[model samples]
Target: MRALIAIDWGTSSLRGARLSVTGQVLESREFARGILTVPPGQFEAVFNELFGDWMAAPHALCLISGMAGSRQGWQEAPYCPCPAGFAELGQHLLWLQADRIALVPGLSCMNPDTLNTPDVMRGEEVQLFGALQLAERNTATLVLPGTHSKWVQVEHGRVTRFSTFMTGEVYALLSQHSILGKTLDLNGTFDETAFLQGVDQSQQAGSVLNKVFAVRTLGLFERLSAAVLPSYLSGLLIGEELRHQNVPPAQGPVILIGSDALTLRYTLALRHLGIACQSRGAEATWAGLHALATKLTNKP
Candidate 1:
């Protein structure tokens, strides 16, 4: 493959990397200009302004992943249904410039949960592939924690199915706008003891709906300090997410892909439940894109 430019353009931020032939990142840059911040029809202008020189490399190929392909993004790249791997995604790339640039289609699958709703992930599919490549494994369960967390199951290198959770968004709504927000000291550092306390409490036999009210009552009664309640609430929600997983003991450590702050909390929660896990971050995106570029180059 020639010089590769990988871009992860998500809701709130955009990241780009120029990679060596072997997939090592030679140069990288990030901007706050995500699709949400870009005016309609200006994506190209923004892209060129931010990364024009990078694209000037001879025969440079760019593969963009994430919300840049959403309906509101640069161009809608129709989703590729599961089970999909590098080849499927490569075949579905929505080309912007013949072979020079394209968007990596996201993945879609029926929810494994009750109701069987359709689930999808944009940027995360790249991270999943990257995680698999980095781990050098064909089968594993991976989790990407964020506003909408995903639990993905891979079989023989393709994403067979996955599920999403609104843990982070719920935490924000509850801690910022809900009644529980009244007493939360939202500015304090995370308190490990309080967080573990919430995690332990979530393990008890009861619906989370009932347990969440405790956040309010615990604060009202001063049983828990207001400053640490946010961490405690975080534990309860994250712990609930962990509790619902039916991860088998033989699938190996659950691969986590996300930022350090989010992954750290997940790591703490998983270990608290005696479940083994491993984590990857930004590198996963670049690696995933590089892998896709390589596959596209070697195609017969």
Candidate 2:
């Protein structure tokens, strides 16, 4: 295997890795140069500027993942349908330079819960595959928490199904735009007690729509401090996200993939629910890309 230049490019940021033939990341770099920051038709030039030196390595091969392949990005790499694995992703790679540089396609599926409505993910697919490798399990439940949290199920090395929740995004909006913002101290530290209280509240039989209003009421009634209401609100949203999951004790510990900050809350919430879990971070992306690269190299 040649040295691999793996990239995880998203809407707000870009990250790159230089990996050895054996899949260990030798060096990595990150920048604020996401697709939204690049000028029209400047992705290649931007890539060359930020990572051209890495590309100079003899026999280096590059594979880019995330929004860089979206219709609004450098090139639209049509989505690879669900039940996809490394082979499917490698087969759909949108080559920028034949046999050298290419874009890793995202995944899509019809969510049965929404009446067979469609759902898709760009960069998370890479992390999902990477988590699989890190956990050494072909089938498991995985969760990626962010502005859009993802709950995924993989079976026999393929992503069979996944569902997206607007937990983070809604939290942002409610804490900023909605009346709830008036009481929340957005900069306050994580209030575990208050957060857990909200989590406990979510477990009760009631619509979140009605429960969210309690943030303001709690503040008005002086039952909770302004400094900690944010954490409480966070618990409500995250707890609600967890409430819909069906992870029985027999399925195995859930695998979490993402930054420490985001996964921390999830870890607490999951443990509170009596479900065992583990976590992996950025390395998952590198491992995922390395897995795809190895698959490509081994192809007949």
Cα-based lDDT for every prediction: 0.93, 0.93
lDDT of 1 by residue, 1-300 (tens): 788999999999999999999999999999999899999999999999999999998999999999999999999999999999888999999999999989998898876556879998999999999999999998999999999999999999999999989999999999999999998899989999999999999889999998999999999999999999999999999999988999887989999999999999999999989989999999999999999999999989
- Model 1 spans with C-alpha error above 4 angstroms: none
Stretches of candidate 2 exceeding 4 Å from the true structure = none
Q: Against the correct fold, how does model 1 do in TM-score?
A: 0.98
Q: lDDT at 265 for candidate 2?
A: 93
List CA RMSD, all candidates. Answer: 0.9, 0.9
Per-residue lDDT of candidate 2, residues 64-94 (tens digit): 9999999989999999998888888888899
